[model samples]
Target: MPTHHEDELDYTPTPHNVTRARTRTAHLAAAWGHPALAPDVALVTSELTTNAILHGSLRGRLIRVRLAVVDTTLRLEVSDPRAERVPHPREASPAEQFGRGLALVGALCDDWGHGPRDGVGKTVWAEWKLPG
Candidate 1:
């Protein structure tokens, strides 16, 4: 079995950091020999990090993103500072500009969930099964 591979980013909850997080996720995925999954992984990263910035943000707290390859799965996790702002997929109006991030995550990833982090807040994670 391949050794587990991991990478991480810690950033302030700024709008610009969402793009930065997406780019890093793509780079990590490609470096792990899963370039074909880069686009989808980037999309998921963008959605999750955007949520972290918008909903899970706490003053003076930073968001953390982790990317890992374990066995044949690619996993992405975003940790934020608000534990109460749990995420779920919900119906959105066609005219709505937001509210669809988790829906997109659900559509793209094989599995996704959220739970309390080691300390103050929560972490949202999604995983995709890698092709042989």
Candidate 2:
């Protein structure tokens, strides 16, 4: 299927770049004719990139963010250089600030999952259905 709108970016994994990713996701969503999805897209972007920065990043490796709109679906993917450290969503206790990122992604997107990338690393993706 042909893509309607798409963008890919590579960023050095850092705490600052997570905000950049979120802003970019929101901008892309609005430009793609899905303004209402901007917030959710941005939230998902933040969650995924933050997780990558905290858990999957390697020294001198870049994190990749890809956002695309195809047919009636909007998808966002975050790639990091760690295949072994996979993500699993679990309930978080009130005192814990972490452990809720994956859960939030799952709740916000229609579907979300992670898998190995080309050679080294993994790609975690989330998708939402757009208005038809």
Candidate 3:
């Protein structure tokens, strides 16, 4: 039987940190014998990391990204230093320049939600079903 494991990586919210997070997720997915799920997971991580940097105020604060593989699901959680603002799916107009990240996340992910992390910031999480 294969054992399930959880992998976590924490980093500061910078413009270049997104790539690092994606790379870490990919490696972990491969290690867990789920190479096919890497792209989707990486994309989802990219969206969350981007949102954390863009909307969550990327000061000197750090962003934490966690990846876990359990059974047939892969979970991605990104935490940043802002708990005041919550994420919601909003209707985007043709002329709108923003507010499509969560929509894309919803379409790609099996399910997702946001909530406070401990006493600090908020964590945005999504899960992807692995293909057999």
Candidate 4:
């Protein structure tokens, strides 16, 4: 049986760091021999990190970007420092500029959810099942 493989990185909540997280996720997916999952993974990273920066970020706190592979499933987790700002998918108006990140995450991943961390903040995660 294949064992679970995972890695994580912490980043200050910033727009530039979101890009860095996305790039790192893409690179990791490829290095793990799942290049096909890179694009979607990158997109999910972008959405999650951006949401963190906008809603969950706090002073002196950092966001965590985590990637994991268990069996054929690939997981991406972004943990930010605001437990109060929970995320949910909602309809975005045509005139609105935001409010669709989770929707996009849902479209790209097989499963996604969020939960509070041990002390403060919360973790938003998405997972995709690799093609067998």
Worst 10 residues of 3 by lDDT: 1-10
Residue 114 in model 4: shift from native, Å?
0.6
Cα lDDT tens digits for candidate 3, 1-132: 343779887888787999999888978888888888788788889889988887775577788899987777788999988898778789999899988888988987899999998769899999987776
**Alpha carbon lDDT at 54, candidate 3:** 78
Per-residue lDDT of candidate 4, residues 42-119 (tens digit): 999999999999999998899999999988899899998899999978999999998888899999999999998767
Worst 10 residues of 4 by lDDT: 1-10
RMSD of 2: 0.8
Off by over 4 Å in 1: 1-3
Arranged by TM-score, best first:
2, 1, 4, 3
Candidate 2 per-residue lDDT, tens place, 30-130, comes to 99888999999999999999999999999999999999998899999999999999998889999997788888899999999999988799999999998
TM-scores, all candidates, are 0.95, 0.97, 0.87, 0.93
Question: Each prediction's Cα lDDT score?
Answer: 0.94, 0.94, 0.85, 0.91
Query: Candidate 2, clashing residue pairs?
Result: none
**Which has the higher TM-score value, candidate number 2 or candidate number 3?**
2
Clashing pairs in model 4, backbone N/Cα/C closer than 3 A: none
